[model samples]
Target chain A: MKPLYVIKIGGNVIDNSENLYHFLKDFTALDGYKILVHGGGKIATQISEQLGIEAKLVDGRRITDIETLRVVTMVYAGLINKNIVAQLQRFGTNAIGLTGADGNFIKAVKRPVKTIDYGFVGDLNNSSVNANNISNLMEAGFTPVFCALTHDGDGQMLNTNADTIASALAVALAKHYDTTLIYCFEKKGVLKDINDEDSLIREINPLRYEELKKEHIIHSGMLPKLDNAFTAIACGVKAVVIGKSDELGKLGNNEPFGTRLSKSNIS
Target chain B: MKPLYVIKIGGNVIDNSENLYHFLKDFTALDGYKILVHGGGKIATQISEQLGIEAKLVDGRRITDIETLRVVTMVYAGLINKNIVAQLQRFGTNAIGLTGADGNFIKAVKRPVKTIDYGFVGDLNNSSVNANNISNLMEAGFTPVFCALTHDGDGQMLNTNADTIASALAVALAKHYDTTLIYCFEKKGVLKDINDEDSLIREINPLRYEELKKEHIIHSGMLPKLDNAFTAIACGVKAVVIGKSDELGKLGNNEPFGTRLSKSNIS
Candidate 1:
């Protein structure tokens, strides 16, 4: 079997029809192995506002009250998952839509409550993810499209950050299939300076990352992404790359399109 | 091997301080249950509003975007789950907060992509909840609080409805152990009319429920709850009930304080 390529996409791509369509087209053109994990946070907020409901965020994370969780489930899993599956099918990508709760593929633990107790958020450390389902889907010639929400051990669903979900998935698939994990986002790659688009960090090591974090050189969002990338590498993933969505196919061909994180810098 | 009780909580329970404190007081008293599935919609919306993000809903569901999903996950599974766990612990109920993605339980299938797809939402059709996790926690005198998010066959995490997650869990647990799924909400029972709060329907059969759905009598949010009730029944769940959350302890003692859904209408 060809080496599987695991890709993590953000929720921004959910409504960006042209970008999604283009990415799917490129994704389908080159075929070896693939899985897509995406996020859908913006769309949910739109709906919440219409309903006169307020959204809360703590430290860059949305607080999942009861109604928000339900709304997101309906959109992320039922609607978005199916929607992506349909789009992939349109381009003959042989796609299958899924959430993390199915077949126990992606697992999580509830995040410890903060000062103002939210409802049900989770920590990546508290969860476990299984990739067998992805293997099964790939064996059946189907590309699995995943949403970010998984089951904690206690017979309930918990919302997970998409970046963390992708990293965990990459670790699972890497150990299972000896594949590469690629995370695509709005930016082309990790940059040293937010303002300087050309200051992309081509390679990242743990020591430098920690120094950068402490010095406030890396942006807040990049902190978690880097952590997840480190985790994927530590968990025996072959490689981790932070790049743009449209150029993911180039990643599989060993193109240095983004910041690369390897085992030495992680575990 | 005592029968497991799977409780499904509503988001409204956490809206206000008084309500939250009261709910914690009551739920903590009934902490001997095997699992707890919680909801969190209001929190996500609050954050979205603050961030200048508009909330969107389709077919009565919230659409999740990357940003919002992250916030909610951190809130629901991270913050809220912990709060419930901590409250239960304060009442001498050894509790462990968890999300559905833990232990590869409660997985979901993502919706295929299409026009106006629901973002980050999940379908509960595909799930493999780890009943042993809940059972073990119970055996160890720990209450495992479950958040509403299940895994699909792939590595992605998708959002799940609390009721749906609870129902699917009950079904999954029933195959191994006698499981009772309880859905707690503000209403005393399933009402015949939305306006007539007193017109409570104590019970409903699948056929009758379907007729109500077909005739558009059951109405919006109630639709999925009803579907979950029937699914639980069909999947061998010992019992299902819809009622107020404050009566959990009474219900725990098998006092039957809620609107019970049984196979037979009345003995």
Candidate 2:
């Protein structure tokens, strides 16, 4: 199978223009089939504030009301996504920016109203992604750039998590390619000590992952990401990397830049 | 050659939800290859007002300052474009929303300043449309839904006229397909009498169009549209149609819906 990379970038890279420029340059220079998944940054929140839509939160999780969704749809899918596509094109990458609604690439269901109504938020499952259509697009020579938005397969657009989208895409596309999912954030990797960047755990397999969890060395903030990485590895993705966005260039040269997780240590 | 429809709809169809829904359903019901170009409606202006970005006009024409450009990008490319794609997807159209930046499908030079600088507006020429790439996307089975936005090759998004985009696409794609360009607006067609709907000019060849102009029958508001339609006809578009959006379904059944323009009356 041909190698493919599914990379996700959060606010740390997107919020800063200089970082985004360097990140995109590295991204375009990397060889092979790749897809970019981007999360909404401070701009969405700032725009929401300007539009006079108060931020709603339940149990520390942000809510997506109708007005808030519109603002995000404009910022994420419209402003940020198109600008990124334009920049990629300037760098000679044939990029196509998309929301899940476009091409029906990912159809997510609205979260059910239980203890709280998430208000236009979408929750995905294994079958939520249209891998065949996405693969067809990549095979046609256009790189796909996805924003953190999905549709209900009805006429409604829903706010979604960018990280989850990246993992789902990797798992789905793994059937056709040697897929590696990379989550680029502010950290160097999963550090053994939270404050020490040099204490980066080079690699973790299922056994070592169990030990790390038992010892509670990973912080709460990193637990969900690690758990998701393991889930993706279990679903056939070749590897999952957690690292800093600035070090993307290192991957092309096979230098150690981040923590890599796979099914087994020997592999 | 295969038949392709390049359709443009303005504020009349987009500003109203009910009208938009019906129009999209009609659009999806039409057979053969089709592309939709949409204009930025009143919502952009509304959002601009809400954002406290004052609208600037020079010589009665709107100026696209940097702030205005951002708002329109959000509204057109992000909000309206994505919603239309989602709706079309719900109708099983397999639509992909796009701006000129996506796939480098269209590249425009920022309008040269002469009398007034239209800050971020884009102007297109014959070579602006990437015909082969667009054809490839269409041949790949994804219908394109474009908003009135284009990008300079250097990575700036620009405001563009949707009607011109539609005509440009029709002219460029004509080399590969038998293309018909349709403009859906508030009127039924180019009326012989401005106040009378019964005075529809069903067909207007070049000679008759010249006569209509000499006789002062065509109003100033209709002149630019007619000039563009004729230019498209001269450029080898199979035909151009001016009609009401609600009457779109009639075209699928070979029923007359709009005034048709062609090289000759017999065509």
Question: Quick one: best TM-score, which candidate?
Answer: 2
Give me the TM-scores of chain B across the candidates.
Answer: 0.83, 0.98
Model 1: lDDT to the true structure: 0.67
Q: What tier of docking accuracy does candidate 1 attain?
A: incorrect
Docking class of 2: high
Model 2 agreement with the true structure over B46-118: per-residue lDDT tens digits: 9999999999999998899999999999999999999999999999999999999998999999999999998
DockQ values per model: 0.03, 0.91
- The whole-model lDDT of each prediction reads 0.67, 0.94
Q: Which stretches of candidate 1 lie over 4 Å from their true place?
A: A57-61, A125-127, A153-155, A205-220, A252-254, A264-267, B1-267
Instruction: Kindly report the interface RMSD of candidate 1, rounded to 1 decimal.
Output: 12.0
Q: Estimate the TM-score of every prediction.
A: 0.49, 0.98
